[model samples]
Target chain A: MKKILLPVLILALVIQLFVPSYMIWQRYDVLKSGTEVKFDIGLFDPYDAFRGRYVSIRVEDAIATSFVRGRYGILEIDENGFAKISRVESEPPKEGLYLISSEENYFSFPHNRYYMEETLAPEAEKVIGASAEAYITVRIKNGKSVISGMYIGDVPIEEYLTE
Target chain B: MRKEKWLLDEIEKWQTEEIISPESAEILKTRYAPKKKINLLIVLFSIIGTLFVGMGVVLVGAHNLWYKLPIAARTAIGFLPLVASQVLVLYVYLKKRDSIAFCEGAAILNMAGVFSSVAIVGQIFHLPSDFTNYILLCGVLALPSMLILNAIAPLGIYFWTVLNGGLCFDSLWETPLSTALYVVGALFAIYNFRAENGRAVYVAWISVISGFILVWVTSLLEDFDVFISLFAYFALLGSASVLWERAGRSLEISGTAGTLIVMLFATYEGWWLSSIKSDITIAVLTLAFLALAIGILIKKQRVVPAALAAFAALLLRAIWALVGLNSEPFSVVFMIVANVILLAVGVYYIWAGARKVSLLYANVGMITVCTLIIMRFFDSEMSLGIRGVVFILLGIGFLGFNSYLVRMRKKAKEEK
Candidate 1:
């Protein structure tokens, strides 16, 4: 154990020597470069002691929400707030275009980047909270994406339109 | 023969307790009979060392020599007291060889030197009076030396490192980096836990708390609101409960405390319910968690009363949430009544539980139920006189009960 520890300690020391103090670099970079997306904001779970809320976001164009709802078809949303999609389509489209809402849920998240319609009421009801909006930035640089940051205002709509 | 055996046992115990050179101890046991020469020498050297250190302090305090001394000179001068003290100790240790006074003196001098190092460095640098910078500078300056020297002084140094690390987390590292540092610290603590005794327990506790603090800080930087914060805390605690279930009962005790602290913080923040409202899915998930935890308690035949209390409190909040407070909906009253019923049921379980576990669960459950009742009473628009009287009576009752329990515990300990 001592022999094994010696080299590891030396390595840690070596790493420390080389590790320049670049504080908050990752936070700054992620905030700067992360992809911005709009989802439906569902609720805010507020804690009294820690003093924060968990904002749930419902992605308007979620394929899995549809699948869970047993809805057959791709979903498309019109500017008139109308949604339609073809179940005849064998697989989800690759373009990743969808009418998204800014709804947020704490745990339940969409599996794929496809559009969703309001076929699942109970699911949507479970997503409701102290608020009605959810939009967050997703870092999509790799094949993976996660909630990088959340937006407080209607920046999701503004960013979607502008970008 | 028995006396000889006892003497040998005592000698062995003393040998372990005395951390200095074993040869010195054996020599002291044999050759170092009490002599005026050794005492005189120890006192003489100690006085000389004290004078040297005093002079060094005076030199530093004189201010005229401050700027004249280069940084290297200043650093060297700052260490003069330590050097002098060590030399004095070494002389006494070699000459008189009193291990008890030598070790104790070494401990004291080492502590003093650590404080002086921090003070002198801060003074010489003309550093601002900010706490974070002071702690960071102190830790950074002392840590490497402490570890390399194998000084027990690292206990304080590592503590300061972790403390300043948490305070400076937002500014010190990206989220990942912060998390990594915390993990590194925790790993160090775990490494210490394999020691021959519980000597590393402090390190373990510090590491766990510091790691969680870093986690919390990182989450805050991500703008996790109070509700999410509670969820995160509870989630982490629940995870820890499952993962560290076998680490030992001592760790479990502390872990339970940690979980309780999180739940208390959740209740205090009002996030326990808001998080649920923010997302029903999360609410349901938390409920499921509570149910699962409760099941664990029941199945294990050892209720984690803290967990039960937290879930019970959550139940009340859920009911309150179901009936909007502003609306004063029927749901609120119904839920509160139902909660009262649940509390009764929980109390019944406490009474029915096996004697071994009942006390533990009952204390925690009753505390939670009492807190809930108190909160409800305080929140309700009752008459001031009645409220005041009730408050006083409840406070007195709690104090009296706790005092009686404490006395009983003390008596039990004395008997043991």
Candidate 2:
């Protein structure tokens, strides 16, 4: 019983570690190789008891009038990395970077929010709103996007807030 | 020991009744007497202490301490409780294998560790997944601990997590993944029933409730016809009752109660009359199924009178639907008859339980009756004051009925 129990315990621990580790590794890979895109967004801060502090953001040109239910919104990115909905498609794009949104009316970007220190979250929210040019940098690969960083004009939000 | 005393008393009674010889009674007493009782207070305190410690760890993890630390420190802090809890569980499994209290406590702590670790990882990394994914991750991570320790606490938490995860998404039945979560929950409930002691009834209830929600969600899908969904739901109830009768008493009751409630809903004219074609199809199918159920019960020679009455009411409503009885007066009469039949079933359960001296059944019956009565009171056009007065009266009546039972039991004891 002892021999069997030890192996099972080790296996459980390994799997538990593997889940979060694998999630992080996947996001890291996307950041490493994915094309970078920037979008101007409206931001607001909210406190979640479970997930701590984060700022919710809405992309400026991500809304669609001709929206279809249960279809992914196809987004076209310009040279400057700003994106607009080209059309809503039932299937994901065959190649290149495109924003895939689950919601029809609004873009449900995976990287819609930036998590931060509980105290600093409100400051980030304020900075995003106060700055004339507030945009978020995201790395998109194979229809998956991860928030790389947030910027107030040319400066990173973290650097701007810290200074 | 209290158990031994009870056994001894039962043996003495049998002896007085000449059901067993004096020597046989002595042998029975000797065989059944308990030996070497463990201190229950120690076990209880140990469980309570572990639970509080586990809750404390979760609270501390949730309290934004991660923000105060550097990235590497935050990651290490997130993993610390998880690794520590795993080690504790392993120690308990190897060293205190026979101690249920210790194993259960350790497993609970392990579950909390799993939840906190996943939550912290998600928060720190800003994982873009929804609550459903987090809940599923926590449930999966805690499954081994639940099975290894034969712990019901972790299993119960897993069940609740799946349930709330479904609610969080507002598409528990609609989403294939959420539906899969419900299936996983049912499987866990079954596993808990088989592995844990004295937990079959609770697990059975959970299983039936989960299945009901699944079927209801399937019914809400756009392409699925309503009549077919209703038929499928009724069939599910019937199959569950017949198949799980041997599993435990609660499964049968859950199925029967679920069927009765659905039939009661079917009787509401507003539910069926609005969609005439679908309504007629459902009414016809319901009648056929109720008839089939009644026939089976009669053939088995186990026909319950209250069940028969409920079925009869449903049958009448079905007939009324066929005849297109849309008059307000006729609908009111139909509703009253159905409700009265349901009330009769509750009363019958109460009377039968009291007569048979089963407190659990009696309480179940009393609750059913009380719930029905309260629902009726609220459904009526009675004033708030009148509703309050009726509720007070019902409470007093319950007390009086309990007092009567106690008096009757005392009389039986004196006679004996």
Candidate 3:
């Protein structure tokens, strides 16, 4: 039991450290290299027991007219520079960005949650939600998407709020 | 300290009275040697300090104080405590292995670090509030550290985490892999667990009662009434309570709680009149629980637990019969009878407890009767003022009975 203890602890430590590091690296990579686009969205307050408070992202425009279960949604920048689901396919676009959805109708996007400081989130949501030009800035690479920031009329929402 | 002093005094008395030799008395004294207060204080402060530090970091992250910092920096800071605690646990493992306080302290810090690492990352990266995923990841990763460090704190935390995972995830993590993860956890616990270690065994039993997800695993049964299925699942747990010492306490409490729930449902008219078809699982579990309860009654001479188990079995039978026959043999009289039986069971517990001179049994009986009566407040048409009076009366009665039992126990001990 004594001999095996250190090796097992190290193994667990590596996995534990690896998970969060990998997550950070993955998001970091996406934000650094991926195509940045805005998506017209609204927010409603929601609470997570572990992650604390956040605004739940609600995409404004129609995500998809038709969704196939276990298919990927290929998104394209519309005329207004807001991302819209252009097509659903079995394979992700060879050169462009795509989002995977295993469950039909529910389009899987990593940018569906915008976390904020505990007391600041609900107030931020109220301000950002009322704006006509409210959008979520997301960076997408390969298939991974990271929420860069929430915005109103090209100004970061945090700039408009009282800290 | 007090216990050690008392034991030493008792040993001296035994020696003077010539109950044992000086050598034997010396050995007894050595076994109960007083633990140093300073060492205990150090351990407590270390644990409390670590907790505060961890919570402070997480709270800072929650407030987005690190928002201005590069994500890399926030991530780095997050991993710092985790790395430090990982090393701390290893140090305890190699040097302070004999110290339970050290092991527990390391375990607590290690868990806090693990949580903060993930939480800060989640905070920095705007990770969605997928608590199920976050907690399960923490629990699964932290599980091995508990076994490696040989600490009860982590074991307790692991069990609680598994329970939360089951409840919060709903049917999301109910896949084969999640169940397999829990099975592996139990196996690891068994590997580390000694049957004699009271805390290890207690946590193990609680984990089985919750981690196995006997109740939540029925996500596949869409056609079945969840309430009827609860009877089957709870019957399964109730039978497990009689696993002869493995689940003796945890299962008894859990099984009794389940029985109470089903008993409450049985008192309702819709439960009997409704056309809910309970499957064969109910019958099988009811029989199993009945057999186990009867066995316990015969072997241990414990009547209340067996009686509660028997009541659960009867509920299962009536529910199961709804499948084959449209006749509602269980009626309003059955409702009255169920309430009466609950009251009777509580009274029986008090009687049996007093007869055995066991305060645990008597107190359990007292609480049982009090709880049963208090539960009736919602349905009873008593005014708020009257209910307050009843509450006061029950409180006084409880204190009076408790004092009487304490006096009797003291007298019996003195006589002995």
Show the lowest summed lDDT stretch of 10 residues, model 2 chain A: A62-71
Candidate 3, superposed: residue stretches over 4 Å from native: A44-55, A64-70, A78-81, A102-105, A116-131, A151-163, B1-52, B154-157, B172-174, B183-270, B279-304, B311-326, B329-351, B359-416
- Give per-residue CA lDDT, model 2, range A1-163, as digits (tens): 7568668877987898788677667777777898888877887888655566788877776354334443565667888777666666667778656766746544455555677767788998877777768888888788776787788878887678878
What is candidate 2's lDDT per residue for B1-416, written digit by digit as tens? 89788999999999999999999999998898776465656655676787788777866776665564665587788888888988888888878877877887888888888887777777665666476667777877887877777665566677667666665556554455655766766776766554334456666766766666554544343333343344444443444344344444555566556645655564454544443233343345445655666666656566444345445544564456457775666666666566666666667778878788978667757777777775656654435886688579867987998899899999999999
**Alpha-carbon deviation at A137 in model 1, angstroms:** 51
lDDT by residue for model 1 (B278-320), tens: 3444445445655665565566566444344445444555555
What would the per-residue lDDT of candidate 3 be over residues B41-85, giving only the tens digit for each residue? 665566677667766655655565555567778778878878988
lDDT of 2 at A45: 88
Q: Give lDDT: candidate 3, residue B282.
A: 40
Native-contact recovery for every candidate?
0.00, 0.36, 0.49
Q: How well is candidate 2 docked (DockQ)?
A: 0.42
TM-score of each: 0.41, 0.68, 0.71
Against the true two-chain complex, what DockQ does each candidate achieve?
0.01, 0.42, 0.45
CA lDDT of each prediction against the hidden true structure: 0.43, 0.67, 0.67
Model 3, range A1-163, lDDT digits (tens) per residue?
6677678778887888898888888889988998888888877887654455778887775654333443677888877768887767776678777866634445555456777767778897778767778888878787777788888787777666653
RMSD of each: 20.5, 8.4, 8.0
